[model samples]
Target: MKRSAMVLLGLVVVALGLAAKQLPGVDGGPAAPIAGPQVAVGAPNRGSESVGVELGPLVIEGRGTRTTSVVGDGGTVVLAAGYGVRTSGAAPALRLSLERRVGSGKWESTSAPVRQDEHGLHVSTPPWSASGAAPATTIAYRIASASFIDAAGVAPAVRSRSVSVVYENQAAYTGLAAQIYRDAAPYCPTTAVRIADLMGDVAGDYQPGTSLIRIDAVVGTGAMARPEIVRSVALHECSHERQWLNYDGTNEGRKRMLAAAAAQFSSYDPMGVGATGPSGPLKSDIRPIEHAADCGAMALEPRGYLGYGGSCSPTQLEAARRLLTGGRY
Candidate 1:
């Protein structure tokens, strides 16, 4: 079975039509700009670094980096680096060093061994403790690297551009969620749901494997500005998480569900923009999952669920209603 694409539905107003009004930032209003460098809490720092020299035939082709922060379960800050180097013979021994700073404090360093694959060399620092840090603490990081002893003994080194991320404690996220949905305040503490605020183009996504809910920085701030939209998107994504958790009541069932879900959305144009094709019809498989999600969101935020505004056919509507009322997927 094909693996499922990440279950992320970009919050698009055009797709929803009249339901568009229910979401903020879609009404031709000025989008809430991401304040700061616009990096996700644990995504790699952006920009590239060049290795000026070469080790035998090996040359750094490209650099891919990501950093992200995780809240709850003893909070952590992670830094990862991926180096694309071209070499056919013996690969070089790559070493990675990561430095971190919290607030005005001095920098602390950690080093780890690098692992190489067909694509490139990859390495990540151990999860740095974020347990006692203040909410919204800006954590700055620098990943430095050195490669030595290829086919011939030679040392080449490079440094990545500096990157920074803010750590939001669980309490801080709970407070933010509570501000949007009063019910969510207790839900966070009771269920121990982890929320990771991401920056850039991401809206919001939930990873069932990790039980991690990622809320785009833009979406989170927009929700704060328009509290009503929060419940709709939040509950919608949360419902997806529920489907992932249950996923037909067995491991194999969950895998099939993932493959189906991934296959369903892959047919759409990126970001659900425009039409699926020149014919201008949305993919048929998308209706049921989306309808189910919308119904779930509506069940929680009834005032906002407006029946997809004729987007669904009578048959699809009937199925969605059954799922909504009877909890049958």
Candidate 2:
């Protein structure tokens, strides 16, 4: 079966207009989704007089020069370096540097501040915006440590590092989506979002596969809004994923009943944007499908059974609670 595009009907993002809400940040054009091959570069070399240490999500396996390329022609590398000294758990001092290469020529290095933590070193370099003549060449860099003793059974005391190379590249945007994927994999397997392409109101589609739920970006927004919004939205949509699985992807029957119940909950639009009256268009022109969904959504919020957002007063929560839980306060 062909995959269905996510429905953006009756959405709310800066005034829902078609699938525009699905794509955020960049304009809705013919641009392709960002992803590319990983460039291979030389690793920083190490010597026998070096010590190796292991850190969470970071491994200084052995002293070796590593080369990684940025997405743009002129980018800056924020390299962090640190050392582990045997002084009552007090980590040693550290330093950092920023290097820039404007073209396909030699790298220009500059000093950067290094902050040391119990684990390692960290640095933040200025934005790399000048790469010489070639305005779009990749920025490559490497990190190494000063000559230190190879402590027995002790991790290497090399300069621990983390790099943040900035660029006005599409791949960087994809990296943002990749971050969302990382978060969705473990905690929100039933729901996910790639914000890079989310437009105005058109959110992604929800498909619950045999093992997990997949939400692809038809349109995405840039890395905007706090993660709390993402978490809340994803959690909200995840409830739909469960609903789909439980109802076998069809809520038509339940929607009818919920729609009837929602009338009692509705004094105005569920989104708090309009009014709902017997003589108004809300009763004649509005669709109850979304109201049913909103009913379920509001039911899940904290004290949301009390209904917040629309003209629907907190009193509606009492009715909704009774409908769902036999009037149990």
Please identify model 2 stretches exceeding 4 Å from their true place: 1-92, 95-103, 130-137, 141-144, 147-166, 169-329
Q: What would the per-residue lDDT of candidate 1 be over residues 206-295, giving only the tens digit for each residue? A: 433222345544544522334556666566555544444344322334455545434433233332212223432355534434445554
Q: RMSD in angstroms, all models?
A: 14.0, 17.5
Q: State which candidate has the highest TM-score.
A: 1
What 10-residue stretch in candidate 2 is worst by lDDT? 55-64
Alpha carbon deviation, residue 275, candidate 1 (Å): 23
Each prediction's TM-score against the native?
Answer: 0.43, 0.30
Instruction: Report lDDT (Cα) of residue 87, candidate 1.
Output: 32
Candidate 1: segments with Cα more than 4 A from true spot: 1-89, 111-115, 121-133, 147-156, 173-176, 180-232, 237-259, 262-329
lDDT, candidate 1, at 177: 51
The residue-by-residue lDDT of candidate 2 on 177-243, one tens digit each, is 4444343333233222334333334333332221122233532343223353333343334433333
| Superposition TM-score, candidate 1 onto the true structure | 0.43
